[model samples]
Target: MSLRVLALLVLLSIQNLFAQQLSPEASIRVLTIGPGYNLNDAFGHSAFHIQDHSQNIDMVFNYGVYDFDTPNFYTKFAQGKLHYLIGVNYFDDFMLMYKRQNRTVQSQELDLDTGQKQALFDYLLENYKPENRRYLYDFFYNNCATKIRDVLQTAVGEPIVFHEPEAFQPQTFRTLIQDNLKTNSWGSMGIDLALGSVIDQTATAEEHMFLPEYIHTFFSSATLGNSNKKLVKQDKTLYTKQAINSNKSSFFTSPIFVLGVIGLFIVIITYFDFIKGKRSRWLDFTISVLTGVIGLLLLLLWFATDHTATAQNYNLLWAFPLNIILGIQLLKKQPKPWVIKFLKFLFIMLALMAFHWSVGIQVFAPVLIPLLLALVIRYMYLVYYLKNEKL
Candidate 1:
């Protein structure tokens, strides 16, 4: 065990001995930390803050902590089997960490009575135990933000009736995520590619708590089941993010710009190949390997992984895994007769992909437009060349 774990155990024992009952001045609040620049921190964070002057306890219970040293960490993360822990930090230390990150921090005091406050605090303490701290983390349902809402409901032993905030607007899960990411960013494109149509469905108001800001907004207007009293008794902004201009990347480095350039080059190469009545075997091989590898990875994400959001992905239609075989055939002096039929099938798949995009069956990355168009043209040219080739 690490020193941190030992320290937490010692702290827990001391708290149990002397702070069984919190003083009337003890307060329990929810802290909402604003989003940071990185993809991992883009969704912001939520934690529970418990403070008591009489007991000399001031701690933040955060559910977002994960160990990078865990065995097979990256593999487990990719398979959606990674565990997150309930981390206990000194309240001042927690604030200082976020302050250094230049993220905004807001707190909302709960309107719970002394008994309720103690119950919630006790529950957090019990949950903080080593065995109880680790949990299977889910992005939309059981992440740090959603844990705050669920834990509050569990501790209060009552339903939380969350009302829509005044500025609330209906949005899908994907859109909620996109709100925190730049449209042309690699992070946004990756999310659009990996997650499927499930996130495209409109999220219910209660479901919006998956995001930290939404947790604050909904909790501000929420009430306990037994009473109409507001769940949040007070609110305060502990830190405001500074207005320093971020170093934005140039458009030249953007996914759309880079992909567009590659796509244009492919189209130009295909045009030359068509005029010369010749096929660029190397180009076909490269494109096929790239799309085939991507397709296989997507297929694995859908079936081999525990990720719920990667299911029913339609990107496979454009990135056919069988293209790898076609690429091999294209290298032969006399390709198989079925290669022509396979190219036609790939063309049809592209058309179906376009249909799916048009009807909102799935939302693919917008940056793929140029690449997809180039692919269609290349496939069509290949079909023509194969059909006209002599035995």
Candidate 2:
């Protein structure tokens, strides 16, 4: 066959195989984010106010800082409005809206990625003086923020009020982008692109205040989020040829996740040991067990997360320490024989899964898999031997 004929056949085959994946529309969804009544919303207070008029929104997601002394809102806005997001909903909505109409986030192409953000910030600190930071601020505001409002207005056919950066001063979009903006580094230009993404209507930004009451609100209101309620479709099939061969590691390459499983087993053991009169101080033992559970949750999050923005999720890296603590507690328990035997079986299974996953990582897999197996086996045997000897 001629090359053109061959190309046509390949295209048809691919189309027939997948039939164009489409997110089934549900009520023309528009996501809105708003501020918590409190200060903790990670974005800014001004954003929350804009989000309050949620008449057009299909889903409203609120974000707030964790209970740490530094709140998430106080974190610098990504040149104002953009955030590091990698979730299915964001992806689905973006793809859908673009297909529904020729909606674009940029007037000109803006490759908004992590490298772009770093390059832009670096340029500012290098070339611009502290007192002359107006150049930096002006470029971000007019080129990034105003262009954003203009783009959304074109799509929604309504004048949308975007959450301008705290540093924002109202100026003509043309003046900002064409005149002052050109003088700054090309990196600064990208910052405008990224910030433009964050506050755009399809992917709005808000301040989420995560209060203890927010959890309580969900529990108290039958209409709200239920932890027990399941999203069954979220479960993905494992061990496919692609899944097996892809460089991305699933449950196996996730060290924190694997440790979470180990911690859970330890907690179960500790509870049983207390029941068997082998240990006391239930609360302390319970804490030891819970550490594993929490670490495991962190592990799953790490795996599910967008690794391209590792810095955003860096807090979860500390989950490793908790996993270690859980291991120590398990070893201290001096397990009963049945418990040791069961753990030995689990260790073998976990090791096999790790090995399967490591196939993708090649040599790195070999080192990580064996080390994990040794840790599980070593701790289990130590507990078993101590228990039998009553030491």
Candidate 3:
């Protein structure tokens, strides 16, 4: 059903229940459905208990990630087979879904209600403190427990105390230390945050997520994922040496390989220059050779091993070394004052502008032309200076 239609049915049900000589002793509750918050489905796999006492009803909070909604419906919820459903959804839509069923609140802001609707809205304004939103300090508050509390109080025809979600603690400090060492690599930030600090290696976030993925593809067969399914392994692609050489590595890889190659080249180039004998152009050659070698190493490392994360650092490793050679060629006996001033202005301006995400270059490819020009200008200055001075 469309969200609008499903909402109307809930409101109609509430009115019918109230008109049919509603018993205050009769229970009423809302079960939210979505990622990590699945309290409504009888057959749903959830963590929260929803026991509908003969005297009252229990609401379940279900969270899910859109279309992947798990709709298990046979389990008795009295004991707590609900909860732990978290699905991705927009914030406003989430709030609107529940306001429709606060049977006790005569006001219906989502639809339309007159006197009681306005009163309930006023009450909501007083109670729903936007400042207390958790993601600001924490977000689980609005999305989980507090939401369920609103439903229960509405159903029972009385005020109910909203339980707080568990607090983040530092107990995992020791375990995090060990884990950091064990899994050391790039992109660990997302893994650490997603896992939380429970510290139990068995349920560690990285292991639960990355491991399942690693196991499914790395070990050859899908037996581990298909048969021993504790968590469903999403489509994580497996990488191989052949694929890395071919172009499959564009997705993500380590920077270590590129770094190693750069280090080796630097050593080789340095040794070669020492043996070849020095000229008046020695400084220019040294800087160009070392910087170029190092920069190329960085580019390769980023491309071959490192995951292409932010574009600030990229696979354009050749740019630096190439600029060095060009700069040496441009060195001069005396630089024009105007040339010096313009180069300085360009470099400083570019550096200052680097952080602006809205800058044209960041937003579009055409913006890069200016950066290329600036690089050329800098190269000319270096070359001009190398003969007698330096930029």
Top TM-score model: 1
Q: Which residues of candidate 2, in runs, are more than 4 Å off? A: 1-71, 74-294, 297-334, 358-370, 376-380, 383-391
Q: Rank the candidates by TM-score, best first.
A: 1, 3, 2
Over the stretch 51-128, how does candidate 2's per-residue lDDT look in tens digits? 111322222111221212323523423222223211111223433433343222111111122332233223322222
Tens-digit lDDT track for model 3 on 1-391?
6866855654453333321222233322222221211212111111111222452322222322122222452231111222333322222343344343221111101211133223332332223233321121111222243333332235333332212223522223224333323222233322232222123223332122121121222222212212332221222211111212323233234333333344444445444544553223444445445545655644543344322222143212223535354335424334344544544543554454453324422221222334334344433444344333432
Best by lDDT: 1
Task: Please give the distance, in angstroms, between residue 295's alpha carbon in candidate 1 and its true position after superposition.
Answer: 0.5
Model 3 earns a TM-score of 0.24
lDDT to native, each model = 0.89, 0.31, 0.31
Show model 3 residue runs off by greater than 4 Å.
1-132, 137-184, 189-252, 277-391
What is the TM-score of each predicted model, taking all chains together?
A: 0.95, 0.23, 0.24
RMSD to the true structure for each prediction, in A, is: 2.2, 22.7, 19.2
Count of clashes, each model: 0, 8, 53
**Could you give the candidate ranking by lDDT, starting with the highest?**
1, 3, 2
Give the per-residue lDDT digits (tens) of candidate 1, residues 295-340. Answer: 8888899999999999988889988777788778887767889988
